[model samples]
Target: MLCIEVLVEEPSAEAALKSLLPKLLGSRARHKIINFGSKSKLLKVLGQRLAAYAARINKGENLRIIVLVDRDQDDCQDLKNKLEVIAVQAGLTTKSNPDAQGQFMVVNRIVIEELESWFIGDIQALRRSFSSLPSISPTSSPFRNPDNGGSWEALHRFLKKHGIYKSSYPKIEAARKIASQMNINENRSPSFQCFKAGIEALLSQENENLN
Candidate 1:
């Protein structure tokens, strides 16, 4: 059986993935979510965590590790390179640098700007979660590209304009609700699509191993 270990930077992400991963992994694979409380804390401890996973893999564990972080204000390429370097330092192959057979034990994905970009990417999912929200056109200004900066703030403002989360956005609650309605196949966020693609690749590799 294939087991996936997902490392996320915050509770909201954990909440969102909790609702989404079961739908993605199905009965063919099992997954565990590890929330690191904050992005700073996660980065501080990431090296140690990856080292531990490398040790487990050396013991012949059928485990795959996924590290997810928000791009926030960081340069995307630099952030990705940092993650790849960490995995290599831990003696594990990353998706960015696969082995000769094209197999990798780790995948690093960034939520472009922030997790709320995913909510902004899928207007239908947002409407499903918050029924009172007016239909938003994907061609509209900010909604057109959900990967833009200030994603959570943009989402909060949009929701507040609709009288939902009028005071403040509840990160975890909104994440769970919006993610539950998200169509993995239909999200418009490029980052979200990349994330979904990474999971699909992991599953594909697992199937190849089984064969």
Candidate 2:
């Protein structure tokens, strides 16, 4: 079995991915999501962790690592390149640098702005999670481009306008709720699709290896 180890930026992303991965990978694939509390913490230990994994892989461990983090103010490609560099420095090959059969050990994903962008991508899932939410078209402006600076605040205001969760945006709870209803087959967020595509490609490779 293929073991996909996911490194996420925070507990909310961990919660969200935990809820979504099973639906995406099915019962066959084994996966784990690890959170580092913040981006700084993640980058701090990432190199060492990847190095350890590289050693284990040399010992015949069937493992793959996927790193996910919010893009925030950083350049998306730059962040991805940085992660790939870290992986390479730890003696691991990335999708950007694959072996003879194009096999890569690490996949890095950047969530544009924030993970809230994904929630904004599938407003219908939010509506399903919170029935009181007003009907929202997928083409709505805020939903169309969720990379706004204050995405969480914007989402909070939008939900508050509908008279739901007026106090604050419960990050973990909201993530889990929305993820439960997320349509993995379709999402408007480019970042989310990139994440999904990475998982699918890994799964496809796993299947080929089994065959």
Candidate 3:
């Protein structure tokens, strides 16, 4: 199992992933994987970094492993399809499985941004605290007061609801708590029993796709 990582914004994200993913790698034998991405206003997002990342990964000497992606939309599947197209354009075979005779695990990205999904909660109510504050329009432009939906605000409600507000800050840090809950890497999280099964199903489907 080759391991590689890239970024989104905060360097702490990379630091956090380093701490998080290695433990998630489990018993797989680690192999060399290229790591690169830049953090800048116009360049931080994966949309801007795809070409550079694609170029780097195209030079693989062995079967490949994918670095993860963001949770902007339910588009991880779309990203995989795009990557397969890109790989085809580059004249390379894209292995679509994590465990196969030779296939490398090449697509591991998390897209669930809100923690409530795993917490068995609702969306409308989840963002109500921040969303109800005000309504800013496209007509407002830079003056359009954007609603704050930071983990800070989200966690406050979560802890308050769960009756954990009295404990400490840890009880209400939404992103931290979400990160703690989500594996991000596929190999972690004992709670994701179905997730593991889905990975197996994906591998099976990919094999059928190959055939």
What would the per-residue lDDT of candidate 1 be over residues 147-201, giving only the tens digit for each residue? 9889999999888988999998899999999999999889899999999889999
Worst 10 residues of 1 by lDDT: 133-142
Q: Model 2 lDDT vs. the true structure?
A: 0.88
Using Cα atoms with residue i matched to residue i, what is each candidate's TM-score against the true structure?
0.98, 0.96, 0.41
* Model 2 segments more than 4 A misplaced: none
Clashes of 3: 2
For candidate 2, the C-alpha RMSD (Å) to the true structure equals 1.2
Q: Clashes in candidate 2: how many? A: 0
Candidate 2 on 1-211: residue-level lDDT in tens?
A: 8899999989899889988999888976899999999999999999999999999999999999899999988987899889989999999987777778898888888898899889888877988999987788766768867665567778888898888888888999989889989998777888899889989888888788899
Write one digit per residue (lDDT tens) for candidate 3, span 1-211.
3333333333334433443344454443243323343223322333434455456656752233343333334455675566555444443343453334554434443324322232222232223423432442323322121122233335455455545454554423443333343443432222233333434443454456457
Off by over 4 Å in 1: none
Q: Could you tell which candidate, 1 or 2, scores higher by TM-score?
A: 1
Model 3, runs deviating above 4 Å: 1-15, 30-63, 74-77, 90-92, 95-102, 108-110, 113-156, 160-211
Error of 2 at 112 (Å): 0.5
Candidate 3 or 2, higher lDDT: 2
- Candidate 2, residue 163: Cα displacement in angstroms equals 1.2
Model 1 vs. true fold: TM: 0.98
